[model samples]
Target: MLRARRWSTRLFNLQRQGRMGTTAPIDGEEAAVVGSAAAMDPAVDWAVPQYREPVGLSRFGDRVLLHTILYHLGHPDAGAYPPDIHVFPTQISIAAQIPHAVGLAWGLRLRGEPGAVLCYFGDGATSEGDFYEAANLAGVVRAPVILLCVNNSWAISTPVRLQTAAGSIADKAAAAGIPGVRVDGNDVVAVREATAAARRRALAGEGPTLIEAVTYRMGPHTTADDPTRYVPPEELAAWAERDPIARLGTRLEQAGLWDDDRQRAAEEDADRRFDAAFDAAQATPLRDDVFIDTAYASPTPQLERQRRLLHDERSRGAG
Candidate 1:
């Protein structure tokens, strides 16, 4: 999990350096993401990730190229192939991908596929109309999907207390006629167990289940947001005590599964990998006329004119 944090932190730093766009930090949420991802078979399971789900995407072999495509908001469909995994371009509009995941599961079910779709979202997304709508459809049709909510206790500037009056986001799933379970999001082992069970049930056509991994967002919502304004220092310190990566490392140490030397080596390895990936991403050639390129199959008259202008500029060495 510390390795996961290393990757997330490196990516977060890259975003700050203008090498990438705004990114949702998963520094504290690594356990929830990695544990859940580890429970499934990457060869079969599908992950419909939000912007913050790099842990899952990385576990599924998503590489720097995936991040490159995501940063540019480039079309991933053309590049999404076996073992590369799937991640929806970070959704600024909350809860938008819920229905899309449902549709994917519905199609998979129609084809009699034995796999589950894991949809990641935040606690704030529960308030959106689409969240309930999609959950209802999944429940009614018994779609092979798991609704996983990483309740990090904040939505940008909004605290979770103000986001909902309910005790937990998992409870909302009850209204949609689905089972809901709350687990220790910081406990990677527990999360893996719960998600594995949920996946089994989903593949059996039992119905959609909502698993709320109760955790906290240790970092600011983004590089642009200041968490100190709304979050008290004491609360932050308390959450820090329960830091997911630290907890996992401690547990592994106790079990003799890891040691300080191993931890340091892992951190160093992750840092080197991230540095190489960043360099590669920076060296990648950007499409010269992407701004004027028509992404659609059929270009409109306006797009055609823009393309011609770009071509003329290139020919005249004015680009």
Candidate 2:
């Protein structure tokens, strides 16, 4: 979680400097992401994440971070992962990944594979129709999937109250006829335990579980957003008091498991990794017309003509 926080900070700065694209900061939501990820067996379980989660997905593999850097660099291959990487590409479309996750989980079950799919989305996604359809199907099919709703209180600029009328995000799960759990998102241990319990239930042939991780987003919805406009100063301050990293660090220190030296080492390691990944991303050669090449296995006549036209235009411009 500390590493994720540090990396997110650097990524945010990179965006400000115009070296990277706009990114959603995982500032206060680190524990919710890292804790649930910690509960999964990377070899068996699959992680389907929305855009905000790559930094916190290190539990899956180092490649997740590497690909994240590439993604921020706007590489076409950013979505391409080698077979061993168990995470799906970060989906920018709201709630679209939910149904995909359900499909993946159902496919696994049909094939007699052993694993559950962990789908992470924000509370805002629950407002979309895709969430309902996916949840309903998962329940009916008894698909091994966990719907983790990271309710960070806001969806871009829209507050949770404006997004839903439900008392809590977890309450929506009842319509799907599945278990709903609300956990303290700031508490890493609680999130981990809840996720582990959900995974066990799924593995035991129970239906999907909806976990509402109630927390607050400490930063803007994205680099393009200005939270100061809508978020009240006092409310922000109140949530700041519950910062997940500090809360976890305090507990670990009290248990004698953490020290300043260890903290510094982790920060240093995170910096080194961010630097290395960014450097590699920048060093990668640009692949011209990569979208055209990858769009179809066999390009139709019109697409082939379009590709040629694009190449010709580039060639003429170069000359």
Candidate 3:
């Protein structure tokens, strides 16, 4: 979770300095991300992500949290992973990956696969039709999928109250006839336990689970956003009291798992990694096929033509 904070901070700053592509800030939501991922076996489970889930996806093929930066920087193949990596490119549209999770889970069951699928989305997504559809389908088919909703209390500039009428986002799961759990999003252990319980139920053929991780987002939706305009300073300060990493660190410290020396070492190790990743990302040759390569598979007929045209243009420029 500390590493995720460092990555998000750097990525957010990179956007401000025009050194990287756009990114969503995950400053205060580290526990929600890490805790949920701690429960799933990435090798067997399919991990699907919406745009802001790079932190959660870290358990799988987040690739040191640099591939997400690479993809945002318009690098082709940055989103690709090995079969066992079981992760796909990040979806930009809100709640877009919800149905994909349902589909993948159902497909896995049909094939007698051994794992469940875990999908992460924001509370704002609960307002979308796809969210309901996916939940309904998973419930009806008994698909082994866990819908992990990070209810950070804000969707871009909009508040959760404006997004839903329910008492809590977890209540939405009641309609789908599945178990819905609302946990302390800032509590790493609670989040992990809730997700693990959900995974167990899914694997036992009890159908889907909806986890409403009640948390807060302490930064802007993106670097381009000005939270000060919509988010009051008092609100930010209030959430600061519940910083997830600090809460977790306190627990670990009590358990004798963390210390000042260990934290210093971890930060130093993180710095070295970021330095290496910066060099690697910059070393890749910019090519005409970069955007085309971002495609998940063989380019469609139209995309192939586009790639050819780009190649020819680059060739002409070189000539």
lDDT of 3 by residue, 159-241 (tens): 99999889999999999988889999999999999999999999999999999998999989987788888998998899999
List the candidates' TM-scores in order: 0.90, 0.97, 0.93
Query: What CA RMSD would candidate 1 show?
Result: 2.7
- In the range 1-319, model 2's lDDT, one tens digit per residue, is 9889898899899899998898889999998999999999999999999999988999998878888988877898787877888999989999999999999999999999999999999999999999999999999999999999999999988999999889999999999999999999999999999999999999999969999999999999999999999998999999999999999989999999999999999999999988888887788777777777788897888889998898899899999
Model 3, residue 228: displacement in angstroms?
0.3
> Tens digits of per-residue lDDT for model 1 on 1-319?
6666777676677777776666667878888988998887866777787777754467666473346334533433323334545444455578998988888888889998777888888999999998999999999999988899999989987889999989889889888999999999988999999999999999888978999999999998976788888988998899999998888778778999999789789889878776776665566566666545437667778888988987888889963
What shift in Å separates residue 96 of candidate 2 from its native position after superposition? 0.8
Query: Candidate 2: where is the Cα deviation over 4 Å?
Result: 317-319
**lDDT against the true structure, each candidate:** 0.79, 0.93, 0.86
Worst 10 residues of 1 by lDDT: 72-81
Lowest lDDT 10-residue stretch of candidate 2: 284-293
For candidate 1, list the clashing residue pairs, or say none: none
What is candidate 1's CA lDDT for residue 306? Answer: 85
Best of the candidates, TM-score: 2
Clashing pairs in 3: none
